[model samples]
Target: MIRINRRILAQGALALALAATGFAAAADTLKDIQARKKLLVAIDLSVPPFGMTDAAMQPQGSDVDVARALAKDMGVEMEIVQVSGPNRIPFLMTNKADIVISSFSVTPERAKVVLFSAPYSVNQLVVGAPKGVAIAKMDDLVGKRIAVVRGNLQDLELTKSAPKGATLVRYEDDATANTALIAGQVDAIATPSTTVQTLASRNPAKNLEIKFVVKVQPLAIGMRKSEVELAKWINGWVEKNAANGELNKIYSKWMGLQLPDMKKLADEARAIAL
Candidate 1:
């Protein structure tokens, strides 16, 4: 027979408590948000067009608008949780934010940790450089210094595709990476096409242009993987907004391009997953 010692009982009780805490942390985020009457959204303010502060230092960008729309539709107030590209997931997982709307590109690896709603936007990754640079292909990246926002999709994709001689310099955020490219700290930059456009418009003398298209990634809202109810609600919201053209208007306002067919893209994404 075995004795029921206090030490063993205490250890087992602690384990159960920890498991319960984990489950509570990940449970029914939609209900929690509704009860609190607020939605905490993670956004990277340094990424222009997607998330940025205007001259008045008030947050204003595509992602910000989207988050605000989501909160408005849900009958809740929005609280922006400013984050960097590398910490978006951490913030969501730690319950620092209810969801992430920060130009988050969906990937298989990321899906393992977070649940993504139907895509609401698309981002085209590209290699950009001054017009004087003769980079027409990935091979041209050889012996070049490339700047990328650390832990972003651009950084991950470029890490896999860049040639052996190419050197990648990681920065903490998109704004810093953009500055590095403009200041000649790096020969090229791996970033979204929107960044290239913003750079050209702001720094006309830099002559920055896209050298080659890297990848077209679908952007979606991200939440903790266990937030099934929240994911379902977000997916429905995206579909409804897409049909009503609200999403398109937001996209065009910041991206200067018509939004792609989100339904078609979502179907393609589902097919790829299967």
Candidate 2:
């Protein structure tokens, strides 16, 4: 009996030690960023207005500005890890990025894998085609070929909502999809409204126009599920920036529109959390 009791206590102690180690490991990301003086941010440069390169090939976009702001707020230098729609979460999960500031839309499916900060921006998933294509509703998508970035929210939502006889051509990323739309490889493309506008402005010959909106989604920062402390910090940062009009300014500068009501979105996010 005495030997058994000793063995049980030893096992309990070992278990407690392991739990403590795990807790520390999980909570250390914020501290690690501070200690290293660099915040590694993941972004997709292919997605213009949200993320893209300027004429000088330097990164310039709303998402890039937001990431820079976050790094500045944290008093750390920013290091951008370029990623695509499908690879953003993978990079975060693998520690290739500390956080993802790409146009990551919040959804129940994605919430299961990564922790999201309260929304800092909004995304309207829209279908865009030549002005001549008469697509005013979902049913009009029937018999149309739609292009979308594979494994993105646009792809998932379009897949769920598009009618039968619609063909979806999946591209590796937003840049490819936009290219296909311009090249007339697809009849329409499902992407963010801002992206559609950017494509239209850049390629007037395509005569691209928004056909209809599929969904309005809130965009948030994405971090690994274990990085609760880091997520909390980012959420606080978003709230602070939102209140000060900084986020709105960034949105207006790149997107040419006012930001959505972040306070309302934050409340909604809290309700979701509860």
Candidate 3:
């Protein structure tokens, strides 16, 4: 009988091992989450209206409400995993969260690495400054110091359109950026419209006013790349909640702003799911 070559068998075994590794790295996350029986939601607790600690020191905000609604739809308990602006996506990539509901905006760059569900909310980035500040438009920001939370959608948008002479001071989070604005360390700030309303209203003495609109970003849930089943489930849940009026009520309660048109988004998501 002819003897089999040991080197050929070794190479074949190595190729099989590599294939198995690749498959494991891309395991079916949806089934894993279902097996776990609890959904791990990543949220940013420092952003008000979207996330923050209530008087009882429990997490509460529009994002928190959305997470609860999703958990309810899935018939699973929600475990809130607090994350900061810079760390939320990392947590998702490292398998620390089933999904992120932290006002995550969909961008083409981000789409390469993570899948985004249909938008559940709309955010308008606006420039906020003292009433007497002369910033009336993007051009007015030239040479002025503006604070923005680094890596946030507001930061990316503002940086894109900022005039050449503008000083875009990046902070670690919303609270710090807002503090820098209030303490007169920065001439103005670029942030979510809801945040501007919450902070300015709470500190009326500061006389902060919306200087101009920077950009409008649609916020959606983010999950691991190629999680088609999970994406479909989330989209269907969002569509159901929107039609039942539950989503609108939650947004109204925390944001105090009229909900954006979600019908088009819901329809798109449903089409994808089907």
Which one is best on TM-score? 1
Q: lDDT order of candidates, best first?
A: 1, 2, 3
**Candidate that beats the other on lDDT, 2 or 3, i.e. the better one:** 2
Q: What is the lDDT of residue 49 in candidate 1?
A: 90
Candidate 1 vs candidate 2: the lDDT winner is 1
Candidate 3 deviant stretches above 4 angstroms = 1-24, 265-274
Off by over 4 Å in 1: 1-24, 271-274
**Model 2 spans with C-alpha error above 4 angstroms:** 1-27, 270-274
Q: Per-residue alpha-carbon lDDT of model 2 for 1-274, expressed as tens digits?
A: 0111111111222233233333333656899999999999999999989999988989989999999999999999999999988777766766788889999888766676678899999888999999998899989987888897867877777767677778778778898889889988889999999999999999998888998899988888987777878888998998899999999999999888898788787766555544
Error of 2 at 27 (Å): 4.4
Candidate 1 on 1-274: residue-level lDDT in tens? 1211222221222233233335445589899999999999999998889999989999999999999999999999999999988778777776788999999888765765677889999888999999998899998987788888766787667667777777778787788889999999889889989989889889999998999999988898988878899999999999999999999999999998998878888976565333
lDDT of each: 0.83, 0.82, 0.78
TM-score of each: 0.90, 0.89, 0.86
Q: List the lowest-lDDT window of 10 residues for candidate 2.
A: 1-10
Deviation of model 2 at 41, angstroms? 0.2
Better of 2 and 3 by TM-score: 2
Write down the worst ten-residue block by lDDT for model 1: 1-10
